[model samples]
Target: MSHIEIFDSRYARLKAVDWDFTDASQDSLASIHPYPARFIPDIPRELISGLGCDKGAVILDPFCGSGTTLLEAQRAGFESVGIDLNPIACLISSVKTKELPPEFLPVAHDVYEQAKNTFDGYVDIPTIPNLDHWFKPDVQKALSSLLTHIDEQSDVNLKNALKLALSSIIVRVSNQESDTRYAAIDNNYTANDVLESFLTACNKIHEAKKRNSVNLECSKIFNQDILSVLASDFDKPVGLVITSPPYPNAYEYWLYHKFRMWWLGFDPIQVRTFEIGARPHYQKKNGQTEEDFRKQMSSVFDLLSDVLLSGGHVCFVVGRSVIKGKIVDNAELIRNVAENHKMVLVANIEREIAATKKSFNLKYGKIKTENILIFRKD
Candidate 1:
């Protein structure tokens, strides 16, 4: 199965696409990112695609951030399972994989009309006492009405699909620009217009899928820690293991997503406990100092070793960040830990991801390029 050697790809040297995805502009409804590197726990699917895609084969993404790795695996025709600390991530993944019933859109449209009409005379939604700061009153009311009606539906799949739709809208409907803090609305407001965000997300989902002619494959997202779930025995061996772990000096998955976490069914407080590189933890502790990060990554690697199958592969993509006037060479030195675990480095892919202006003033302030390290078990 060529399991002995690390597979190579054009993306290894040049940041090239390894698989086929229709143009984002062509698929107007899709939530495809302008920046591919934004994907958390990413797998180079185009590179992995060259490995092979056999039906019934399975794949696992331990750090499956919003399902990018899982989606690619499924697109490659393999059954896949994903786990993430963020509930919004799990929701996004789950909704993306579900193959909406043919009648879903038409039916949902009817519900949309009902929601709009219900808003026609009401003028305002119930005052969400805590939410006025983030959204206009009219927007909040429009959202609640849709959420209430969507909940009234008896069908579970439809309900989830509807929820997924709603979840997708959080970015556009709010003062939140990107998934970053600067892109957010005034936090002083306690109530977020969750219901409105949900309906907008639902509409986006239907539109995105329709544009792609995508038949989303079956997959499941667990809103739990990968470490806790790894002990469970699976019925099949995952043919591929594609995921990117948290990078040192980067974002805290929870805080970067705290607002989203609070709006969804998840509790932001609980999510904060598990998120890596959280700003609070970063500042409170030693920060991403060389010694601290090395120690932390080593343990995480060991935990990962326990989950991977014999001879299976683990690909980690990371970037160097300036922390206190020094560069954190995550990919270079990480091999030190890999060797300790008896893992071999197959390849190192270099690339870049967007960074903020403040990032530039730091020790590694340049919009630093990242690396994709492919490790295979001996």
Candidate 2:
């Protein structure tokens, strides 16, 4: 049967399953860090198993936020690659997919003790912009000391794990209201609070390590823009792609994670400048528009066409966006772009966003439902 016929046969079955995943447990390794609008693990898990792709086929996620697709692919025994421009997102993804050594917990305990004992008089705080505004004096000192101890570790994997643990707790212990909100509030954080939160985060990582038993080495994550990647960059051909591109003016990931990136020695400004569909990108005079968004997605589809093997599949989980008081059908826009690149739209399934899963505030854009568009490369 032709690919279109095959897709038509499976369309109803795909739509029959509940895509909301309301009671699904998202408290796995994905919970190690806080990321806005992350794809529930079930989405990728079902796709990887249900897509009927070859067992040896490699999966690719171009807009890999926190590596949910890569982790799911790894769990399903498929080699996967994830690409993102956010440094903190890259770090979180790398830590999630990379297996921690058996000695990680013991070593981390020592590091935590050292950070706690040496935090009183430590003086190596990095020059963060508006440090005083976000972090209290005592909290800043404690975090600096913990970072110093984390940096002293010789093992790259262990060090990165520790760094991620610290990064996970940075927002909670700071003046920032929460991970989703950028506003500052009066938070009475202490040095001991910082130390305890770090330790708690480390313990969670240890527990997550014990729970997940997968070929983590099979997943590779890159901290770079998707536009910069080419088909030749992969050693093998890509057979499947699953990703969720950001919505226009929905949320500012860079703005919310700037403090964590700053603590981890990354420049958030660069991420903000290049981040597609960011609020700032649209607010500026003569800034980006719907046409620009289409052009960018066209380039992405072009890249996917070049990289995907013949008959490979791509699934895009996208939502509608409001621009200039008009709603834009992002799913249809992407479908049009893919058709131009010789991709056949197989199915379009709509799913409601769970009440608890709504990440953005209503003032920006209310995304009640999202479309899951599946296409096959011809």
Candidate 3:
């Protein structure tokens, strides 16, 4: 069959499958922390089940933003691996899959008490730009004190969990416009009640941990760029790979969480230089374009193809991008790359943009469609 006819057949097959997941809870353990542009867990869950991965097979999410795929794979009783360049993303993913020890709750309560009692104690806050504009004096003090107390916890897992919890509260208490927007539109929203917000966030994390008590020991999440980590050996061949890679010229993730990363003691600048598919990286001045996107993604696909087991599946949830009046079909781009790597297109389903999941505004033009492109190794 011709390539156009092949694509049409796959598109039709995807349309016939039910993509509705209104009944699935968006408030899973993965929801405890926030990350921009996270795909729904139902997509990965269904893909894994549909692929029919055998017991002990390894599932991989190369751009595992916020651990959505990892959490779903764990719940389904499979070992999973996630790789990302963002430290905060790694932290959130790690915390999501953590199985709370018996001592987690009591220890968390103790830490909370320490933080409240030592609320006045001072710690050197990271020197973030526009710090004063984003956080009020009192809010800064409370956050520093809380982070200081959280760092005091002896258990690394519990400490990181609290840190993740603290990261969640940053947006609620800052001058940032919203979760999706990179630029801050100050509406005079100051977190006057920082302590209360921190406490509430801690309680929510505790409850979320209790609710998602699955043994997530079957997963390994790495805080490194995808290209850097592809050389590491997996215990078993990857049976399935699923992820939502960043779209070209859209969503500057590091800038979006700049203050949050600083508040939690992370150097956002360190990862900024190597962030794949960032908007600035594709600017005309950068001497890059949509073709660069295809090249970079092709390299990653080559890496994935090398590690994948025979007949294993790769699924990418990507959206079309419009830059300088040129439209790039990301799904088709990925399909072409995968085909060159000896993979067969399985499906390309265009799905409606969920009301809550719509993050891009008119400034970025309308992202009227997203494609879930599935491919199997030949």
Residue 58 Cα positional deviation in candidate 2, in Å, after optimal superposition: 1.0
CA lDDT scores, all candidates in order: 0.58, 0.82, 0.74
The runs of at least 3 residues in candidate 2 whose Cα sits more than 4 Å from the true structure, single-residue gaps closed, are 1-7, 10-12, 358-363
Query: Whose lDDT is greatest here?
Result: 2
Q: Give the worst 10-residue stretch by lDDT in candidate 1.
A: 18-27
Predicted candidate 1 versus true structure: per-residue lDDT over 1-378, tens digit per residue:
001223455224423442112221122322632211235322346546644433454677776766667766766667787877877677666666667666777657766777777875663344332455556556666666666677777876677777667655644565655655444464322123444344455566777766644455756677786545653545555555666666655566675555444444467777776665444555554544667667766775666576566666667656666566576677777778887888877766554443431111122235345566767765
| Model 1 regions more than 4 Å off | 1-37, 40-43, 53-57, 117-130, 175-203, 211-216, 285-300, 352-364
**Model 3: lowest-lDDT 10 consecutive positions:** 1-10
What is the Å distance of residue 291 in model 1 from its true position? 5.0
TM-score of 2: 0.93
**What ranking of all candidate models by lDDT puts the best one first?**
2, 3, 1
lDDT of 3 at 153: 80
Higher TM-score: candidate 1 or 2? 2
**C-alpha positional error of residue 345 in candidate 3 after TM-score superposition, expressed in Å:** 1.3
Range of the 10 consecutive residues with the lowest summed lDDT in candidate 2: 1-10
- Model 2 per-residue lDDT tens digits across residues 245-276: 88876668898789999998999999998898
Candidate 2's displacement at residue 347, Å, is 0.8
TM-score against native, each model? 0.75, 0.93, 0.88
